[model samples]
Target: MKTRLVTASVLLAALGVTAAPPPVSAASLPPVSASSPPAPAGEHGWVTSTLRHMSLEQKVGQLFATYVYGADATAPSAADRAANRAAFGVETPAEVIERYHLGGVCYFSWSHNLNDPGQIATLSNGLQRAALDDGSKGRVPLLISTDQEQGVVLRMPAPAAQFPGAMALGAARSAGAARTAARVTGRELAAVGIRQPYAPIADVNVDPANPVIGVRSFGADPALVAGLTAAQVLGFQDDAGVTAVAKHFPGHGDTGTDSHTNLPVIDHTREEWDRVDAPPFRRAIAAGVESIMTAHIVVPALDPSGDPATLSPRILTGVLRGELGFRGVVVTDALNMAAVRQRYGDERVPVLALKAGADQLLMPPDLRLARDAVLRAVADGELTERRVDESVRRILTMKYRQGLARAPFVDVDEAVRTVGAPAHLAAVTRVTDATLTAVRNDAGLLPLPRADRSVLVTGWDTAAFAPVATVAASFTARGARTTARPATLPSDQAIADTAAAAAAHDLTVVLVNKAWDTEVGDPRASQQRLVAALLATGRPVVVVAVRDPYDIAHLPGVDTYLATYSYTRAAMDTLVRALHGELSPRGRLPVTIPTADGTGVLHPYGHGLTW
Candidate 1:
């Protein structure tokens, strides 16, 4: 038997394919160079050549990075197979990748895709083996991606070197620190064969009430956010050999609504948008960030079509590509998000997003609906095969440039050794120690008069209080009798009982968060009442806003306040050290805290106190 190899010319002629105009303009895509990490300078002839011979279905797969319900790619259970079939029309993740000719796969905790570092490494390597070794023609390395933004939006579970998060980095105001954190995060990710991390959020968080991007954003100041975003991009890409995605393009920082639930319309005038929202993204592009995730929110100033940025040519192609001069891959936010899905439905949204300038359609609600629609569109000439090739060029260029072509497999032992190891976790403490801020120190009460006193620390959420217990342990080291308890509910009775308990201790520490979303008024009324009741006890009360620093705006009467910006373990360990004057509180406010009635600034963006 003789093995026959099909030539590129034969493949193109058989498919009747002509080169389609690439989505990005010539001005946007500079000459490619092996040295140019910022731009795919030389187009890596391999990428374009490989893209040319790819089948239409294979090329379409390169445009999607989807979610599938499975932990094991090679040995999926019956439940995983059924769930994957319902969502992807495939029985296993490897099968779905082979079926879709997928460019990437996004991992989610709920999808059971991430359990531990070792398991994820096995799955990632298995997916690569399926795509390349499973006898597929014109195969490419898989782009394994996930949201590992560290602090609040981490996809991988614990022992993963948790930090105090983006706002905390912004509070510390060190681009070097931001870069270090991204480097640490990327080290762990690359160890597991995951190449891309959707992080270093470029959205300049201007709206205090933004439910979606609160602590995820660096800060409200565009310059501050831009500096950190660029640092992070460099850290992840240049230092760690992983791609860092600057996201929700055109900014999701000013919206009060969350795009995960519904569409948000940003009303920034063109000039206002340029001044407020565009800076971080622009800086990110300048920093050579290869990927940018589109926002599901509408920016009327950029695109008057009322289309979300994810499905808007004016914003994605015109503004992001043409204006910002971005030539790299443009990945849309989850196509299944309510903002894009509700109006366009499952089938039509992927095509619109791609037509609107997205290179990769992420997390389409139904993979079959999205995959088939694009396949049909191309076959009908509704979309040109050339267009599909253009996107695949960008995708393949990324894989090849990142050296995924040469080394697609990872050592599972190395992954287990590197992720969440002592060195990474120790860095977390050093980073978080710099992020602890004291906005109010009434009566010079901090470093508390004595450490051998009774202290009661209370919070209504389990995650926030989990760290309080650790902080209490640190307090106990100082001969302090500390009580750490969680309400995990904002009921009036729970607040009253917690406050009553607070009266028994000489020092009462209240940990509060923005518990839930509300259209108006306080988001956590019971936490506020509990604070007020704690104050009435005539004992010294300390309040810490563990989630969002804005929790202080709702508690008007608290005398001493601190902002940890996140409930991550490193932050908790540092908090106790800061409380007892072991380490100085160094963090400044990243976002201003408004007065209780939202009338005036209680603590400005740069406010922080010392011992």
Candidate 2:
């Protein structure tokens, strides 16, 4: 699964066979007809009428949604204002939208765009007011978006009622869990006036060594992943009114390289691609997912050209648009990524993506370069005005369908209380309980005596969530005397010290975390050594993998194993309760745990133990 690709075009061309993708109808999920979407509805009369009056520059502007670094829509403070100028050469995101007449904005924690629910709500309202005031003669609303995928990617982390991510939901094998999480997440975002959350990751992670899409993917089984993806899609749009984006199109699942850094290649032939990768996307489109984000990886089998999918017309126009019949917005994954940027600079990427059939350009390196390039492309006949209108119509249609056209603002006070509300967290807690997978309990150490035990909790700090002190406090509140020691690296000194500390406790519960990486042959060798050191004490040791589930594959000596899938507050809280017998370890394995060397399956999918 982690090997180089043979040239499909060279082989097929020599055989005198067409190098195009096999007839998509031959696939399990038959291709939907690539017919034109119906005209805008009566409620969407504004969308159609507004598009008719748009200038070339305005239409080009609507295709982009860039990130800005400020807490305010209009910078109210010197610090916030300076952040905006430094990041985007503007005083606020509002100014960015106005300067470009941009149709959308994206938020990220690194950009200081999210702090608290009230702040997010205020900024969103202010931005929307500004957008509505300036965009298309105030007829259109900005499509605000963020990568709030919850488990591994969450723009608003704290006080947001985060849940265990896709793989965890897949392990639960409950469409109810996926729908509940999506509805909760989407409603919270909508409450903040953010209409889009780039979520419901449709990539099926069949390769254990994939660097970017491990826990984000639902699982390795395409059929199961497809069903869950559709559930989240429906939940986000129909139930919550938030636009759900099925991401990393054509599957970024089997790559060893991170597209943010390097271009990875997937060599799956048409049949293999349909079986292992295309199901979730087909299901998402069938579920009426509002957007599909393109991957930056090159798929030689899909198109023999070396162009990345984001820049390949064959993949985007021919495969996704034609074979999949996705008439919704096509989102291009951050245009500044290495796979797209390494060759195509800021100027060429956006125009190429547009010509390739993408409707939106996200996070381009330079807003001026990207928007201007598309405008020039149209003027020079590289792209036609009709093509630009086609994309803008799609974008406007999505915004109107989501009710962003009718009511584009959220109540600040209500948004403050709605995000991370008690009801939402309660639902999240119940779902989190279902995602706890107990793979091994040979010593039956779980459900430990609450009052009598002196437990030691120590392990690598992944810097995800629910810090070790919080976990230890949870144990302490349960009447156990708990000592917490959390570390980052597993140097010899760190491992020896933690192992020695394990000797003082009646029970040792250590956490081992490892992220998917290109060099994943032994991604956590030092962490594995630390676990071995703890087991060397000859005491009952319970190992909890808080990030990716593949940690257990390399730690065969451990007598107890648990996977929380994510370290969100909800997950950690539920995990503490599960350890105390408040709930059972009921989640099954979503993806098979392959050996560290990627040579064999150490734990098959759906394998789990319950107390």
User: What would the per-residue lDDT of candidate 1 be over residues 1-611, giving only the tens digit for each residue?
Assistant: 11111211221121211111111111111111112112223557667656756788888988999877788986787898998878777799898888878889988888888888889888888888777754655777889999999777888787677777899998898877888798888888887888899998988776667878989988777778888898888888887788889999988887778898889988878887887788888888988999999999988878887888888889888888998999999999888789887667788888888888899889888787789999999888888988888888888888876667667778788788888899888888888889988988886888865546898878755653376677677778889888887755457887778778888998887777773232346546667777888899888998888878877766767779898888877787788778888889999887766655555666776789988
Q: State, as a TM-score between 0 and 1, how close model 2 is to the true structure.
A: 0.91
lDDT of 2 by residue, 257-354 (tens): 78998888887888889777898899888878989999999889999889999999999999999999988999999987788988777799998899
What are the per-model numbers of colliding residue pairs?
7, 0
- Pairs with steric clashes in candidate 2: none
List per-prediction Cα lDDT, in the order shown: 0.79, 0.79
Q: Runs in model 1 with CA error above 4 Å?
A: 1-43, 463-465, 515-523
Model 2 spans > 4 angstroms off? 1-41, 76-79, 135-139, 462-464, 515-524
